[model samples]
Target chain A: MFKRIWGWIQRFSSPKHFYDISGKMIPWFAVSALLLGVYGLYMGLFVAPTDYQQGESYRIIFIHVPAAWMSLFIYMVMAIASAIGLIWQIKLADMVAAASAPIGAWFTFLALVTGSLWGKPMWGAYWVWDARLTSELILLFLYFGYMALQSSIEDQRTADKASGLLAIVGVVNIPIIHYSVEWWNTLHQGATVAKFDKPSMHIDMLIPLLVMAFAAKLFYAAVVLVRARNEVLMRERNRQWVRELVEKI
Target chain B: MLKAFYHLLARDLRLAFRLRHELANPLIFFVLVVSLFPLAVTPNAELLQEMAPGVIWVSALLSVLLSLDRLFKQDYEDGSLDQLMLSPNPLVILVLAKVAAHWLLTGLPLVLIAPLLGLFMYVPAEANGVLMLSLLLGTPVLSLVGAIGVSLTVAVNRGGVLLSLIILPLYIPILIFGANAVDVASDGLSVRGQILFLGAVLAMSISLAPLATAVALRITASR
Candidate 1:
């Protein structure tokens, strides 16, 4: 049974097979992400109760929390794929890792911007030296570094291996960096009142946040598939199957 | 294996000695950076003292980064890297030796001079010892981690900027702990925890970074 599953995965690893499979799957992901996104936004923005403490500005949590989750989630995915690519020499996995970088970066940027907007009213500033915010900023830098390294190398294979190594290294350091920053932040600021609105999450807010997070993940899947398909086409352009597929398209 | 490691370390040190200017550039950069802060920021001793830990640590980190390109590029250029790869000894041992040599040439100098830089920055006299201790524990980790980046990009001409981009994020934890140790000490607080964290990071990097560096070197060199 294991061998059979492994054989299936091996077949799916082929660019042509992956291209066909992803084409069929991408629309499902896109449509689900769209439906979920609309419902989530409506519920999160309109239905959730206003925070008595933070008032309407707290609504930014709907965007900020989900984006931050995606930022971390996407990096985890990228790093795992990178490790697989490195260990197994799987081109498809490398392509997936490469495709994940920009999407992850966008999520990280969204988290930062939305968090800053939330902070202005709550923390009385556009930015704070809070541990969470600082760590998110570092994560953004990591994504940019991965992309920069990828683009600098001319050869696609070399770029994949090098950036994959970097992604793995960055992932390993993320937790340590996050904790160190947290420690440093607390040490420097001895008496700042911690006002991060961590009230008991009601179901109304929880549902939408969870829905939006799922939608963001589905969106990642749809976009990564699209990008991975493009990578496959480029890498396999000279092959007969790809030529046929391109001609058909 | 031990003999081969010694030979590789000795050879790298000899070459570094012969190319004295390359060895001096990063030290010079470190001094220039630390000196510039007084002029660029403020000459106020109190303010400088407060900013001293962060300024010195950042300068040392950047100088280490500035010197990373020389880690593997010369050997790569002169075709000795291929020969090193072909050697019967395990690549990880050889790479570790190279990284050790790199730390001696670059990191060790920074550590030794950090106390002097701290004085120049007007750091509290009590903090100078902590500053030197932090750098001593921290710079080896920089060399070890920086070796991975240097190995990855050794084949690519003019990868210095790319190298910085990739490695700088990985250096943040060390920077945080190292700077904070001195800062805490300057504030007359117990810095034992920060010192312990730096040592842990150093130990972890020493054990793991060489293996990663060896793999990266093999990957970059194979092509």
Candidate 2:
């Protein structure tokens, strides 16, 4: 069984094989993302009751919370891909790590912007150094750093290795950053905005949130796979199969 | 291995002294940046004191960041970095020695000079000690972590800004702990917890950062 599994792994490790497989999987992920997104947004916008306190303004949480979750989640994915790439020198893994950067950065940017919009009505300021907000800002910077480090190096292999080490290092620091921000906020006794979820969170609110979270994850899958396929084509462009496929197109 | 590490450390220190201008730039930047806050922000002593912790920490961070390009660039340029890579001694030890030298030159002086800056900012005399101590514990982590960034970007021409981009986010935890220690001290709170946190960061960075730096160095230097 182990040998058979290892054989499957070896087969999928080839760029051509992985490319063929992912091309087939992308539409499934894309369609699911679209279907789930439409339902989640419709339900979140209309079915969920407005917050008793913040009223209609609270609806932004549907986007803000999921984007925040994706920002962190994408970083973890990048970090793991980086680790696997570094350890095994898997080109696909490196491409995945590279592809995740801009997507992760966009998610971080969306989260920050949506968060500020949410903050304006609640905190009376567009920006506040709340612990969560502060940590998310730092997370955005981490994404920029990863992207910058990758782009600065001219050699792809060296860039992958260097940025992979950084991703691993940055991942280790994330928990530390989160905890310290929490500690600093509490010590300063800054005006703490309560989290989006209250003690009595409704099932109607919960359903859309859970659905949106899945939609976001699915979107990530579709996008990252498409990106990874493009990267694979670029990196394998010199190969016979790639040339033949290109000629056919 | 210990002897080799000592030699590397001593060599870096001697080189730093020989080129005094590079050694002095960060200190001048530190003082200038801290001084700029009062001029740019309010001159009110109370407000300055309130902003002092963050201001000091941020300036210190920028100064360290400004100097990080020097950490590996000079050696990389002179081809000594290749020699270090080829050395029989473990690269981690050598990297750690370089970082220790960095802390000695940049971080130690910053720690010593922080109290006067605190006084200038109207930080109470009681909190000055904590500010200094916090820098003392915190800046080594900066040197160690910054070393990893320098090692990664060392080969890229004019990687100064890119190095900062790669490093500043990683510096957030240290900044939070260091600034909060001073803030807590100014408020007459027991800063034992914050100081301990800074110490913990230093410990963690010391053990881990050099290994990462060494790996990055091998990757960058080989290419």
Candidate 3:
């Protein structure tokens, strides 16, 4: 069973095969993302009732929370892809990891911006040195570091392997960094983050938030697939299949 | 295997001592930068005392980072790193020996000099001992983790800024706990928790970082 599964993986991960299939799969992902995002946004922005405390302003969580989720989620995907590439020498996995970096960085950036936007009216400040907020900033730095390492290396294969190792190292330290920041925050400031608590989010509020998170996932799939397709074309530019495809196009 | 470890450790130590000036540069950078905060920020002793922990830790971290470019570059350039790798002994042990030598050259001095600079920062004299102890436990982790970064980038030309980007975020945990230990000590609170946390991080990095560094060196060598 393991051998067969491995065989299937080897087949699917071939750059040419992935290019052929992912081109066809993008539309499905795009349409699903579109439908879900539209529904989720409408329900979240319009249908969900206003909070008794913050009134209409709290609705920003619909975007902020989902972006925050994707930032962390996409990092995990990048690291896992990098690990697969390192251990198995899967060229496609390396491409996927490389393609995922910029998108993941944007999500992290989005999460930070949207979070601070929400903080403005709620906390009367554009930003706070909250533990989670600080971690997100450090995570952004890690993503930049990974991307920088990838770009600085002139050799593509070496870049992939080196940055892959970095992603794994960063992932391992994320928890430790987060915990220490939390400990440091609390040590100096006594429970200043209490206002972040929401009063047991309403079911109506909860449903759209869940839907938005799922929609964000689908959006990521659609985008990452497109980016991975580009990576495949570039890395395989010298191959016969790529020339043939270019001629056909 | 033990012989290889000791020999490499001794060799690196000897080479480092031979270049007495470069050996002292990062240590001097540490002391100079730590003293700059009072001049740059404020001369108030009360405020300086409060900010001392963070300033000292950040300076130490940066100086360690500045010194890290020397860790693998010479061996790599001379092709001795490949020779070291070709040895029958496990590469991880060799990597650990190099990192230990680096700590001896660069990290141990930071621990020793921190108290003298701690005096400049008006750190509580009692907390000065805690500062040294925290740095003693913490700086080895810095060297170990920094080795992984240096090994990864040893192939890239002018990888200094990129090295900082890769390694500094990873250093945040150690900085927090190491600095916090002294801060807590100064506050007359029990610093046992912070010290223990630093030790835990040190133990983990010692076990894991050498393996990562070995892998990174292999990757660099292959390229």
| Model 3 Cα lDDT, one tens digit per residue, B134-156 | 99999999999999999999988
**How would the candidate models be sorted by TM-score, starting from the highest?**
3, 1, 2
Question: Residue-wise lDDT of candidate 1 within B1-223, one digit each (tens)?
Answer: 9999999999999999998888888899999999999999999999999899999999999999989888899899999999999999999999999999999999999988888898898888898999999999999999999999999888877888888888898999999999999988998999999899999999999899998998898878867
After superposition, the stretches of candidate 3 with alpha carbons farther than 4 Å from their true spots are none
lDDT of 1 by residue, A6-88 (tens): 78877989889999999999999999999999999999999999877888888888889999999999999999999999987
Distance (Å) between predicted and true CA of B74, model 1? Answer: 0.4
Q: Could you report the Cα RMSD, in angstroms, for every candidate shown?
A: 1.3, 1.6, 1.0
Query: After aligning candidate 3 to the native by TM-score, how far in Å is the CA of B208 from where it should be?
Result: 0.4
Could you tell me which 10 consecutive residues in candidate 1 chain A have the lowest summed lDDT? A190-199
What's the lDDT for residue A205 in model 3?
A: 94
- Candidate 1, residue B76: lDDT: 94
- List per-prediction Cα lDDT, in the order shown: 0.91, 0.91, 0.92
* Clash pairs detected, candidate 2: none
Off by over 4 Å in 2: A1-4, A192-197
Order the candidates by DockQ, highest first. Answer: 3, 2, 1
Query: Looking at candidate 2, what is the lDDT of residue B180?
Result: 88
Cα lDDT tens digits for candidate 2, B1-223: 9999999999999999999987888999999999999999989999999999999999999988888877888899999999998999999999999999989999999998998899889999999999999999999999999999999988888888898888988898888888988988999999998899989889999999999999899889778
